[model samples]
Target: WFQQSESIIPNHLVSVPHPYVSIVKKCTPFPIEFVVRSYMTGSTSTSIWKNYQDGVRVYCGHTLPEGMKKNQKLASNIITPTTKEEDHDRPISAEDIIKEKWMTAEDWQV
Candidate 1:
C-alpha cells in the first residue's frame, strides 16, 4: 500500500518494515478528525440514526429534519468531528471545541 501510494504521489514514503511506515516529512497535528456522513445507521446506540429516533434533532451540529428513518440518507452531508483517543475515538462538536478553546474561531472556520 505504501509503495502504491508513493507511485501515485512521490516524496511521502519512508523506509520501514511491512505494515509499518512513516511519512518522509513531519506534519502538523490536527485537534480533530472531520467526518462527513451521508446516511444514518442505527448500528450503535449512540449513532446518529438512534439519536434521531430518540428525539435528538441536533447532533454534532447538524439539525436533522423530521420523518427520517433508519439507514436513511440525510438531506445533505453532515460534518461530525471526533478526536483520536487511546482506546477509542470520541465524538466532539465544533461549537464545543471553540467554546472550550481547543481551537480558535478562525482555525475552526478553516
Candidate 2:
C-alpha cells in the first residue's frame, strides 16, 4: 500500500495567456509582400519562371516582360500583398487596401 503526503498550502497558481494572441500581433498585416528572386533553378525558382511562360505576367505584382533570360535578375523588386483572412490582410494593388479603409494606411505601409 502507498500513501501520499498533503501540502500545507497549495502550490502557487501561475496564469499564462493564450500564445495565439502574441502570434497574431506579431503577424500584423502589411500592404506589400516583397519577393526577391536571385536566379532560376530547378526547384521552386523554376516554378516562378514557368508561371511567366504561362502568361502569368506578374509574380507577386512585379511584372515580367517577354523573352527574359533564365537566371537573369528582375529589373526591380516585387511587392505582393497578403490575403485579408491570413492576417489583417488584403489583396495586392487593391486601391482600398492601399488606401486602408480597414486599418490605418501608415501601418500597411510597413
Candidate 3:
C-alpha cells in the first residue's frame, strides 16, 4: 500500500517484523482525523448515526438530508473530521478547525 501511495502521501511504516509486531517511524501525528462514512451507522457518540438519531442534522461540516435510514448507504460519502487533542474526540467543522488555528489554512488544503 505504501509503495503505491508513496507518491501521494509519505508513510511512517519502517518494517513488518512478524504477523503481529512491526516497527514504525516516530512521526508526529496530526491532531485531526478525517472519517469517511458511506453508511449512516456507527456505535460511538461522535458517530453520525448517533447524532442523527438524536436529531442533529448538521454534523461536523455536512448537512444531512432528512429520512436517512439506519445502516443505509448515503447518497454520497461524507467526510467527518474530529479533534484528537482531548481525551474524547469531538466533532468539528473544517471552517472551525481553521478558525480555531488547530491547523493552518494552507495545511488544511493538503
Candidate 4:
C-alpha cells in the first residue's frame, strides 16, 4: 500500500523494524484534518449520522438536506474539518479555521 501511494503522497518510511513496526522520519503535522465523506454514516459522536440524527442540519460547514437516511450516499462528497487535538478532536468549520488562524485562507485555497 505504501509503495502504491508513494506517487500520491510523501511518506515518512525510514526502515522496517518488524512486520508490525517501522521507524519513520519525524515531521511536523498540521493542526487540522479534513474528512471527506461520500456517505452519511459513522460510528463516532462527531459523525455526520449522529449529528443528523440529533436534528443538526449543519455539520462543520456543510448543510445537510432533510430526509437523509443513515448510510445513504450523498449526491456529492463533503469535507468535514476537525481540530487535531490529542485528547479528543472536535468538529470545526473552514471559516472558523481561517478566522482562528489555524490555517490561512491562501492555504485553504489550495
C-alpha-based local distance difference test score of model 2: 0.47
Clashes of each: 0, 2, 0, 0
> Model 1: how far is 5 from its true place, Å?
13
Candidate 1, run of 10 with poorest lDDT: 9-18
RMSD for each model, in Å, please? 5.0, 14.5, 3.0, 3.5
> Cα RMSD for candidate 4?
3.5
Candidate 2 per-residue lDDT over residues 1-110, each given as its tens digit: 01121133222223324533221123444334434455432233225565665666665445667887656776654444444454353334434555545556664443
**TM-score quality measure for candidate 2:** 0.41
CA shift of 3, model 4, Å? 11
Stretches of model 3 off by over 4 angstroms after superposition: 10-27
- Better candidate number, 1 or 4, judged by lDDT: 4
Model 4 compared with the native: what TM-score? 0.73
What lDDT does each candidate get? 0.74, 0.47, 0.88, 0.87
TM-score to true structure, per model: 0.63, 0.41, 0.79, 0.73
Q: For model 3, how does the per-residue alpha-carbon lDDT over 1-110 read when each residue is reduced to its tens digit?
A: 65467678777877777867768888867799899989999979899999999999999989999999899998898899999965799999999999998888987887
Task: Rank all candidate structures by their lDDT, best first, as comma-separated numbers.
Answer: 3, 4, 1, 2
What range of 10 consecutive residues in model 2 has the weakest lDDT sum?
A: 1-10
